[model samples]
Target: MSNEDFLENEDNLFVQKRVPHDDLHELVKYGDHPIYQGLKDDQSKAWIKKSLFEKLDYQTKLNCVKEEAMVIALERYLIPMISENQETSYNLALIRICTTLTKGWFRQFAIDNYPQLINLDKDLLSIARNVIEKFPIKRKKPVLLTHDPETRVIFDSIRPYTEILSFFDKLEYDPDDFDITGIKITSPVNGNISVTAIITTLCKYNFSCNPSASWSASVIILPSKEMEIFLRNYKSSKYELISDLTTKYIFSLRIKANTSGTSWGVGEDIWKPIYVEAKSADDVASILEIPGLTGDLLFKYVLDFLNPTLARNGETPLKHWVNELKSEGAIPIKPEQHLWYHAWNYELKSLFM
Candidate 1:
């Protein structure tokens, strides 16, 4: 096709062919449509440019060329006819267009620029909220924010409450608190003996523990007093370690590795250490189900540990052992037997086994 024909064809693709003014489409197709040719003509370019500046000044109160260009492009080309007013259909079309164009940024910008639009018609806010909740944005994690009634007001007002809550949710604590001072046991330590040491340490330090929580690779520290009492109450000889509670609080500690090194060499090497709670031997066994640990072993561990307690009217500590076993490792399973996966799986198996 000729260059003019090609440009016309491309422009036609952008402008809908079937509209109320079908004659306009035919007129444009024949290169005789006044509006179509006017829009396409070099002479009309000046008017188009002027129109954009006018709209930008009217809409945003600014007249910068780059800013005006985007507004002009959207007004003349993208916005549907139905979105020209504040009526129900207009609001809906506006939301649809904003969603199509801006995705996640729509809500924040809409709230900033069009607070009256949301306040005058709550349905628009609701629609926008629903759309934003489902749309994923490029950020640290999948967006989990939901649209509640209260959030509707927050969005309309650009309030600080929601922003403050969002800030706290993303906060990460300093790594030093749990890592450096917490218990550290090297491999080859007797399981039962290690358990005893852990419990004794906790009890002596007064660290409170909950035996029911799953034993996982988490870094949280227990209070010192609760840690001490736990150690005094735990006793088991056969297992690798008889943690008073299966779940332990761990903290990431930074250790200095090299004295003569520069930069991070003399800096801290970080490691997470866990504080464990004691559970029934059966619970412990079920928790320890290290991939190869059979169902029988799982059952035996629960039964043996809880049997004496059960005989003495104590409660069975194990809950949903197999499911816990199945969910033991990191999700979105690793692609290779790398160090991180190996370490993660090893830690998981060790905790449960």
Candidate 2:
């Protein structure tokens, strides 16, 4: 049977579930058993159980419980029943548990946050590489993701929206083929973002409002018949068109508008995104509303009006960037975890590097 079918088969003997509280009476009857001492630096059984209870995240906690359950189940039942030679189903369940746990762990890992992993030991790095291999993703047909870790994880869980998403794992979209649409802010927006304009597909597609769909706010109506494609993708699916490819770490994007014309704003001294000057969301929507903007000298109205200080280049995958450090034999010191880890999920800002 396939992996999914086997996992669903209730007729199979062993699956990872909680060992009954009543079942633990058997362990206590053994009285200070050596088998129980093997947990977490030989801590007392109570301490071991407490540690598992304290774990956060659905999968991590489940993994801990499954591990403890397996140990007890093997010692109490499987080993004793060895003479019966009916270990195949039990062994399969245990193996599946480990495999499932590992994939879950990999999904949760964010390589960019841990700068220390730039130089992993050969043994550990091999396993890390293998886990990444299990999910092969191509960067082309990129989806916009949030910089916020909490929101990013939520986005990651609902990924591959294949109905709405255009995924090309190996082949890439041509950068030359993709340019900003002609629609740009008509009037001076100044610094207020809520006034920024947007079109169909998303209403709360603002950085100030819904951070998850903010990418739509920026690149409204990707030009060409592609707009029809995007609109069709948007209209027909319940799934959101955008997705976060990486769980918590993705490469950044940097582009200074390759300008067509130059227009001086009312107060041009301040430097911010052209979207900041938007009078309304539709004004922001107008930035790329129409199709076919070959910046060539159409009117010279669309200026390369970007802050010179902004990073000119876009982002690279953390894996690609991190490997360079490994090649250079760098081993960074571990950084402290955030004190308020989930606090930034509500922050309002464009997700730049």
Candidate 3:
């Protein structure tokens, strides 16, 4: 197909929008950042050229987070406190800075600053909270943020593809049967630890191949010999498995990779699961772009790839598409984006596209 044909094809309509970082940052007082003066910088430059519905840069969604010196940044957000119900409350000016209320050492700042924390821009809160969890702080009290009650949200926890590769390295299994039972989740450290679950992963090709391709996970029983390191890393370690799983895979919850870098982990407190769900929701459904990946669009995207057409240049369309992504430096941003890289083939896995 010609350039015009490619652009006109419903499958290839990449919606480019005006970059609003300049205004957005200004709105949130991000423009006055001492280190950077202008609204347009290397960061916004990247986003500027990026279309709203552009193909994934393949960076972990965390890469999209606005990173800052944790302590310094935390100091700025203010939370209000109620000292009294009457004139005393108005006179006291009961507002707390995040730093003073948070502990001196590594500890959670959000909880103490919760009333203020809830006010964070929804997307920023997800990336920011997950990043905070990565610090070596005591996370004994993680409070979950609330979601809008209007719509239902789905979630999936993804380990980086490296984790999948490390676990599946030891054994082989039938693609047709793909048994979760026989898949031994033995760790080098915990030779025969019991596992909670062996979940077959779902990788979406359309968004990102790096983490999406890193498929499958076997949760190691905690406090066991295993450190849950993936103990090894890589999806190429599982690419062969992926090539097959791609064809048979089905629906998977939208993935949320904890920035903590833990592959095999023990559960946190009772509220842990809910806190995770909140973060996971932040990662996936946080952003929706029209002319973007809806069920219909994704379906069409898969159909286009499945029914590839020959081109005058002697290339299959899908291969060309993958090549184009590569050409644009859409290489996997390693060091693990989410927890896993997942993959799927079109026959049964088309929905993943």
lDDT (10s digit) by residue, model 1, range 1-353: 11121122111211222221222223123224323223323531222233433333323321121122222222233232324332444344335333432233323344345533332322333333332354323233322223345434423332221111122122232221211112321112233221111211111111111011112222222332454565455555312222323345221111111111111111121112322232223333233223333332322222222221111101111111222333685332323222222233344546676
Off by over 4 Å in 2: 1-34, 38-86, 92-284, 288-346, 349-353
Error of 3 at 348 (Å): 22
Clash number for candidate 2: 18
Give lDDT tens digits, candidate 2, residues 1-353: 11222122111111122233223323323234423243335342233333533444544444333333343333334433432222342343234334332223321332222232122112322322332354333243332212345434433332321122222222232322222222323212322211111121112211111011111112222223443454455543223333221111111122111111010110011111212211111222244322332222111111111101111111111122233444564422122112111111111112322
lDDT of 3 by residue, 84-114 (tens): 1222321121122123221322123323433
Candidate 2 TM-score, C-alpha based: 0.20
CA shift at 10, candidate 2, in angstroms?
24
How many residue pairs clash in each candidate at the backbone level? 51, 18, 20
Instruction: Output the TM-score of candidate 1.
Output: 0.18
Off by over 4 Å in 3: 1-23, 30-107, 119-353
Worst 10 residues of 3 by lDDT: 262-271
The per-model lDDT (C-alpha) reads 0.27, 0.25, 0.25
